[model samples]
Target chain A: MDTKLAMHTKNLNFFYGDFQALFDVSLDFGANEVTALIGPSGCGKSTLLRCLNRMNDLIPETRSEGEIYFRDQPIHGQEVDPVEVRRQVGMVFQKPNPFPKTIYENIAWGARINGYRGDMDELVETSLKKCALWDEVKEKLKQNALGLSGGQQQRLCIARTIAVEPDVILMDEPTSALDPISTAKIEDLITELRKRYTIIIVTHNMQQAGRVSEKTAFFLNGVIIEAGLTSDIFFNPKEERTEAYISGRFG
Target chain B: MSASYTGQKSYYGDGMAQNIARRRRHGRVWHILFYAATTISILALIVLLLNIFNAVFGFVLIEDEVPPTELAPGGDLESLSQGELISLLEEYLSVGLIRRFNFEEPLAERSVTDLAALVQVRIVNPTVIEAWSLQESLFQSDMIRAEHAAHPGTRVQFRSWLSARFLVSPQNPRPQLAGIRTAFFGSLWMIIIVIVVAFPIGVAAAIYLEEYARSEIWYNRIIEVNIYNLAGIPSIIFGLLGLAVFVRALEPFTSGTVFGGVDPTTANGRTIISAGLTLSLLILPIIIINSREAIKAVPSSLRESSYGLGATKWQTIWHHVLPASFDRILTGTILAISRAIGETAPLVVVGASTFITVDPKTLFSKFTTLPIQIYQWSARPQSQFRNVAAAAIVVLLVLMLSMNAVAIIMRNRISKQRRI
Candidate 1:
């Protein structure tokens, strides 16, 4: 475990209108490592991921109390733009959603909007190649993204995120919508990605958390029940709820 | 369940089979009913089209005292030039008649077609003694020949009430030379103005209402409900609104007086500009409602994707939302313009001149649209006028259908460009 932290949350609470969804969730993501947020449905794992980059602000009447910090400074502090924060911390959704545009444009749009003044063609190519999609889509770069398959579209979304060179990637169930073969490909890609950027993935699959993540956090009822090394959380008993959730006794 | 079904089969005496048969019978009944309904609708449309076409073409019993061929140097007067026709008119007509012709569009300045028409009307003096509808000409031709044999010359041919001459000539009280040129241009002017004034504004308002306005807010809800209600209101009411607003209050602008083009005495605002602005008002609510539906149909996930990439609200709307919805917005606009093109009551309340000889060449020109011309001609007591109105109806139908086809082609091109 490296003591260097990429991002961390301190006693974060979130509300949708009057209903609180996340309560007192504090966790640290190690620099250049993958951390998995494993929880059942309605356990607030995705909600916390959205809060990290202020995506929660898009939902009306949702409020975030407490703080989220990238490096050492709070992301919500005065004079920090949400747009600038999101530029550094990008997100990949549960379902693959690519803009209804050319596959090349889909990856280049983030960079273009964020004022990336460089070789756009090279950026698109490198981003696609980095996500292992360039070989499959090299010939059809100008074709619409919606024509791609589900797995290809998911990979394109990841490529789109990395095109802006974000420091952290927030993936909400990146493989939950994919088939077995696509899921295996993404898990393998995540292992390769861990060397360059910090990754936080929220998933329902406990085995996915065990396979790809160095640190695993178990969430139950809007609160983190246990957070530790993957081996300790999977094999050693810290909380009965953590063991019961991992072993499939009960969620 | 299998054992229960086996036991119950005899208990109810084949009730399961009877129930299935009953359901099948119900399905058959609905299917036949739906089939008959569609057939009736198509049959009604066919009947309507046949009736219009019947009036549009047919036979005419033409009688001329000294036939046109006898007066012209060549048998075909139509092949002559304007100068040659003027010379022929001078050779045939007396000094008094030639003087009267000079009071109107000078014969030298008139088109060759118009001069030839003048010769046929005055010197050749042909009169339509009798006429038959298209249906009669095609089916009862022998009876028509026998019936009109008593008349002089029986100079009857399959004369189309709608002709190339009818399309190019100006509106004449005589249906023989009545043309839709002026009204066609006026309608075209009206549609251009409507598209110009309504499209960008309607789409902007729709985007604001759908993308920016909070639906739960009081003012936004009020605006939304009012727009929906406005779409359903009678077009005549919009005519009245336009009369009060654009026709009266904005008279200086609508009459082109503000542009310093028209004389104040003539700028009463019942001009083409007024009609166009009124029609734009009538079509706006429809365009806005349709555009809102189009913008709404853009999946929210697309917006989320844009936002997740750190794009602002306007950026998301402009980059992703607007482009994806452009095709549908164009469709809505086409439909709205179609409705505006066929509108009569609004143009009527806007004070379209019932009989305007001059084509609408400027915004200040007095105008009459196709539907207005159709309405005016159809109301006349003369049968010829009614037939001519039917011709106008055919032109109007073609205009609308062609407009729809053109718009649909544009939409398909966009779809192919964005094909998934």
Candidate 2:
């Protein structure tokens, strides 16, 4: 494995108003590798994913105490622009939400707003092709994005995010709202994306975490229980809680 | 298990059939009540429409000072063009009457249609001696003829009060010569200014309140509550506000004196500009509340998605929020404008003229809206004036409905283009 680091959080603490949501959570994500955060509902896995892009700033009275570094640069530094950080780290939400615009515009708007000065048609095509959606949607690029099925819409959202050329893509339960067929397609796409972009995914399905990620971190009660290689964590968990959760004894 | 079985058996035995019947009876009662309410509203609307239509068309006894054949050179007044009509007016009408008509607007500047209208209204001078409701005119022809015979000089003929001449001519002391042209132009001008002034400002205020202002702040809460209350405030109160501010305090600007006065004699701040600004204030709260609701209807997911794509807040609102809610905003605008069009108390307080003969030429000119004209006519002692007012009501209704239709069509087109 390559030794280059992509992102790392050191003792990250997050609070929604006065209620602490994430406590003493630390983990490392390597470049060009898929890292999965797995936990039950309200376990703060999604919260931590949002923290990487500073998306929690949108919620009122949310405060974070800790340090997150991206490519060795302090992402949460006072001088750092959240907009620039978000541009470098794009996101796909749990439910697929494409803009209520045409398919071409769904991909083009992000690039245009980020000051991309290239052949827009070419960029749209490349982004769509990378998500494995070009062949399905190429004939109707000008149609409204809302016309696509759920799985295709999620892929379109991914293409829209990558159109801005982000270094890291954060996906929060991207396949939960989709059917089995769509879930399989997204898993295959995620595995293929691991070679080019650093991927961080928050998921509730332990099997999905084992299937797509090279490294897996198990979260419970707003705290990281264990972190290691995917095979080591699933086959030989060091913690009893991790082992219990993986074996479906309790969430 | 025995105790639970006993409880269930006792519950089921307690008039189960009666309970279902009682529930069905209650639902039937509610259904009857709702149906009765709808019927009452529909019946009221129908009665109102019938009353207006009754006055619009009927039998009338007309008496002309000079018959059409005597006034026109070829005994066919309808065949005359602008030049011929002007010459005929000059030849037949008194020099004093020609001078009066010219003083209102130059004869040379008037179009062919205007000149022809002048011939019918000024030269022939036909007067409506007696009028009958549509029901009486249709059912009692012998009675009408006998009544016409009693008035030997009058001729009996069915007349529609809402006619081409009624739309073109200006108000006259004689009910037969009165028309709504001035009031229509006044309303058209006022509404144009209202849309221009209120639409953008209302939309901007809505965006600021909904998108930027934090609801937790005390002042933002105050603004929100105030807007809700303002929408409920009596329109007459807004009229009083307009009189105090636009008509009196800001007279110089409202009268266009600040911009080098065009008509200093008539520019007394009771002009179209003042009325338009007053109406704008009257509907601003409505526009704001409706637009706020529309903008609020845009899903938070859309905003989050835009933000997640590295787009700024303004960009998110512009690219996604505004377009998605544009049709709803237009619907709100149409409602606000409709309210502004029908408003009379506010315009009356702001000094709309009751008997203006000249059409409004600019924002600085004194004006009278359709509702004000109807109000003035209906207040008169003469029964004939009431008939004219009824005709005016028909015009006003048609105008309002057409405006709403245009706005709805525009909204539909935009929505269709963005259809998923």
Candidate 3:
């Protein structure tokens, strides 16, 4: 099977004011594969994920000192617009942040922003269908996004991210706040999503990382400890720290 | 083991121990004190409100029917109660009483009874009546007959003073004859002009400072310091500044006097536009400060999300921030306007008169605000004008309270809509 790298990073270093957050991070997100970044809290996984789309540029004091290439083009190049970059590299936040708008508007927000002049109904329906939310929410698009259940809202956020027609999707702890049923549903959706788009997800759950991603990178204290196929990383991690963290001996 | 355990016991006392029990009692006492202080403040406010109502209503009932006691001449009104007072008043109305009382003219030609009629009316005694009758056989007119018919032989008191007539009557030079019509219209004109001039400017400045200016320290500091200082400035100072700038410097455009051959001083200095501009300046800072706060209060996450979706700064602010902050900004504006309406010192300093006979018709026309009129009436020599002043105050207070209530309702509606 021939697979291409959808996104690649080279020697990326990030700093928040005077404090360095991510040190010499380099990783590739494979096309049509789920890549899970597993780490304890404050281990730079989310920071590295944000660099893929230049979301860190929103913070005034945040500065990065390396190149991040997406589809072989430098994502952080001066020629690229941050707004355009965000449109092509859609993200779902840790918390389900549906805009305080109607469910229909929430799903349609990205399309409208990108000046989608086509039929909104078809686009919204297709996007919701892909997120597995069309049947559940088809009759209630007019209701406020805030009125939806947590699980529904997270799916709505995911649907919102996908509607922008991005090449890659970044989910930062997408199902961390959901119930067991909702988590299972999102895990299934992630597996299904691998058929279409490149997916990079940061997860705290070691089992979730093994179950969802084809490959897993375990990060600890702003450094990647191990990166390998998910089965190898789970069954026989080479690094002592990776084994200790995954086996619940140390976090 | 017993000795070590006893050492630990000193550090971590049991809940049933005396020290821990005492600490818990102290915490409870503090909580009780906090609640007591809050209740005491509320009780004090209630008592103050009850006292004011008692004093106000006590006088309202007693003075509702009498020809307001406040309007009666203070000491020995015997001369004012007599015959020639009506003719004296009528004559003074033609030439202008302000000039006569203040200028001391000769008795033959000087006709008007003067602005101090509450005291001056007593001069018309039976002796003066007999003298005036012999002197003026030429003044036998139906108007005189009607004036006699108007003065029924009822003794005037505080109770007979308040009538529907007081509300609609035009202001007279006499304290008893004075009404709120001119002052009411003056306040109306002032508010209209103020809103017209201030609202757009204040909102524009706020939008610029909050949305467009992104932390350029110098401009931000200037805006921050200016807003804070502006809010702190005594409003009357704005009145003085308005008198200097609008009344004196920009008088040509506002009063339209200096351009054509219009009499500059009469047309320029004491116009409604000047008063309104003064009030606008007085409230501008508050509007800007409150508006900025309202904008700031809108969650930054909302802005980030909008921008993340490729919305421009103006679009984000207009579509998201503005909708979210609309209620707060409106509430702030209403509060600022209410403050402007009740302000007396600045308007007083800017030369608002007490008793203008006619209502202000245009921006450049002569005007008198309610508070200034009340101030002038209260300073008169007669005690009877005091009642008139009180009644005027009641009207002004009612108007102000109603405006505040409307503002509160608007604020509630905005918040309720958001909540729903």
Q: lDDT scores for all predictions?
A: 0.88, 0.91, 0.75
Model 1 regions more than 4 Å off: B1-14, B72-88, B96-118
Question: Tens-digit lDDT track for model 3 on A1-251?
Answer: 25798988888889998999888888877888899999889999999988887878766678998888888999788798878877778888888877777889887877986899989999999999999999999998987778888899889888888888888988899999999899998999998888988899999998899899998999988888898788988999999988889999977
Native-to-model Cα distance after best TM-score fit, residue B305 in candidate 2, in Å: 1.5
Pick the winner on DockQ between candidates 2 and 3. 2
How well is each residue in B116-183 modelled by candidate 1, as lDDT tens digits? 87877777876666778998888998988887887756488677878887888778887776899889
Between prediction 2 and prediction 3, which has the larger TM-score?
2
Worst 10 residues of 3 chain A by lDDT: A1-10
TM-score of each: 0.93, 0.92, 0.78
Instruction: Indicate the worst ten consecutive residues by lDDT in candidate 2 chain A.
Output: A1-10
Assess the local accuracy of residue B78 in candidate 2 as a C-alpha lDDT between 0 and 100.
66
Candidate of highest lDDT:
2
For model 2, give the interface RMSD. Answer: 1.0
Ranking by lDDT: 2, 1, 3
- Least accurate 10 contiguous residues by lDDT in model 3 chain B: B126-135
Point out the higher-scoring one by lDDT: 1 or 2: 2
Instruction: After superposing candidate 3 on the true structure, give the runs of residues whose Cα lies further than 4 Å from its correct spot.
Output: B1-153, B156-164, B257-265
Task: Give candidate 2's error at residue B364 in angstroms.
Answer: 0.6
Cα lDDT of model 2 by residue, B340-388, tens digit: 9999999999999999999998888989999999999999887788889
